[model samples]
Target: MTNRLVTLFKFGIVGVANTTVDAVMFALLAVIGVPLLIAQVISYSCGVANSYWLNGRWTFRDAAREGNERAKLIRFLITNLVVLVLSAQILMSLHNMLGWSLVMSKTLTTLMGMVLNYMASRYWVFRLAIK
Candidate 1:
């Protein structure tokens, strides 16, 4: 496979791990009476943390410019913040307004977030530096 395709494949692997962390955390929190929005935030944060570390170290390692860990982190945070707000709103709308199950709502939001995240991470947060 080409380099870009390889990076994308690695990203998919990391995404699976991140999603597992997020879904499990969210389910645990929500099952124990935590507020839905709060649970979503907490769980998404867990996933974001995982995404940053793994994507930086593995998926985007080749593209990463050296000595800019802090900058990359800041960019990752900004990207994820945008993703979180959108996902949370969608989750709420699906569950509360449209009478969807929490699982279904979360699944939908997660998928949407995955796409947004991959784009932002590839083209912005972890953009390849022009040489």
Candidate 2:
């Protein structure tokens, strides 16, 4: 239980780092006149890349087996792609249909997407092989 908690804490810390990457990239793109959706997509892609590296190396270090890093990266990209699409849709709906601020909409969608991403990555993308 303690070990699981530690893992979760590490994951959260890594997530915070990823969030900063995403937010800063998004803001920078927006300031340079990028559309909200486009800026979000670019920023989210950067965050996904960051998350894949940090989470695989640090958060789930024990779960990373002696295998091809490329394969793991592909799996990570596939998983995050699904989350990204869903999150984008949610953010777009809130920002476009409901007139919510882009920042607030992205924040809400990101929180929801984070839960789904963690579950999918832990159980499906990076699960340890059982003997």
Candidate 3:
């Protein structure tokens, strides 16, 4: 329990870094005339790639195992794919349907995605292997 909390804290820190990558890249592409959806796809992919290494090394160090980094990265990417789809829907709803600013919608979706990622990472992606 306590360990989970500590891990969550570390996860949050890593998430901020990842989110910054996503957001900054999104902003860059947006300024260059790329559509938001396409920008998001590219930005989020970059972030997820960064996330696997950071979370595996830091947030769930003990949960990582030998001989399975490739498998773990695949699982991590799958989890992020689900989360990204969900996030895109939410972003579309808030920013496009509801007329919120893109930044605001992205912020809201980022929070939601962060929670989902933590849950998935803890339970599925980074779970300690049983004997």
Candidate 4:
């Protein structure tokens, strides 16, 4: 339990850093006149790679899976895609049904997605090493 909590703490720290990276990239792309959707895709991809590196090195180091590096990266990307879908649903529910402000909805979405991301990273992307 304590270890899990510690992992969560590390994950949160990495998340904050990755979120900042995403926002900065998105803002830079937008300011340079990239279309909003294009900017979002580019920024989100940046965050995905950042998440994998930080989480692998710091957040779930003990759980890092033993496998081909390419396979691990592929799994990480797929997990993030699922996380994005779930977060989109949460955001719609919070913003549309619950009448939350856009910022509030997004904040909630990010928090919820973090849980999924951690679980997937631990059990799937970074599963305990084979003996």
Candidate 5:
């Protein structure tokens, strides 16, 4: 139980780091006149890269090992892609239909997707180790 809590804490830290990367990149792209959709894709890609590195190196370090890294990366990408679509839909709905600011919409979407990302990564992406 204690170990699990510690792992969760680490995961949260890594998540925050990823979020920072995403927000910064998104803002930068937007400032430079990139389309909102393209900025989102670029930011999310940066976040995904950060997530894979931090989660594999720290959050799930105990399970990281040889022979499974490629599989793990693949699984992680698949899970992230799903979450990305969900997030994009939510953001678009809030921005287009509700008159919310893009930043606000994206922030809400990010928070909502965090749990889904964690669950899918833990249960599906990294399931091989536990089994």
Candidate 6:
């Protein structure tokens, strides 16, 4: 596979792991009486933390090291914060407004955010410096 494809494959793997973490946490929190919105934020935060650590060291390791470490972390946080807000909104709309199950709403929101998440991670947060 080409370099981009290889990187995408790795990102996909991390995304699965991240999704697992998010879903499990969300389910646990919800079952324990946490509000859906709060559960969504807390669970997604866990996934974001996992994503930063793994994706930095594994999926995007070959990305050009143009920026400082602090800057990279900040970018990653901002990108994820944007994604989280959108995901939360979508989840709420699907579950509350549209009368979907929580599981179905969460799954759809995650799928909807996946591509945009990957694109921002690759092109903005962990940008490769062109040779």
Task: Point to the candidate with the largest TM-score.
Answer: 4
Task: Please provide TM-scores, in order, for all candidate models, with all chains considered together.
Answer: 0.74, 0.75, 0.77, 0.89, 0.77, 0.75
Pairs in steric clash, model 2: none
lDDT for model 5 comes to 0.85
Residue 57 displacement (Å), model 2: 1.3
The C-alpha stretches of model 4 lying farther than 4 A from their native spots are: none
Q: Per-residue lDDT tens digits of candidate 4, residues 34-108?
A: 999999999998988899999887787665645677877889999999999999999999999999999999988
Q: How close to the true structure is residue 12 of candidate 2, measured as C-alpha lDDT?
A: 86
Off by over 4 Å in 2: 89-108, 129-131
What does the lDDT come to for candidate 3? 0.87
Candidate 4 accuracy as lDDT: 0.87
Check candidate 5 and list the clashing pairs.
none
Whole-model Cα lDDT of every candidate shown, in order = 0.88, 0.84, 0.87, 0.87, 0.85, 0.87
Clashing pairs in 3: none
Candidate 3, residue 77: CA error in Å? 0.6
| 2 against 3, candidate with superior lDDT | 3
lDDT of 1 at 83: 88
Taking the tens digit of each residue's C-alpha lDDT, what string does model 2 give over 1-131? 78667877887898999989999999999999999999988998898889988888887886676457777778788888888789889999999999999999988998888888888777766677411
- Comparing 1 and 2 on lDDT, the stronger one: 1
lDDT of 1 by residue, 96-122 (tens): 999999999999988888889889998
After superposition, candidate 3 runs with Cα above 4 Å error: 23-42, 98-103, 129-131
- The digit string of per-residue lDDT tens for model 3 on 44-89 reads 8888877998898888887786437787888898998899889889
Q: Tell me which of candidates 1 and 5 scores higher on TM-score.
A: 5
Off by over 4 Å in 1: 22-44
Error of 3 at 14 (Å): 0.4
Model 4 TM-score, all chains together: 0.89
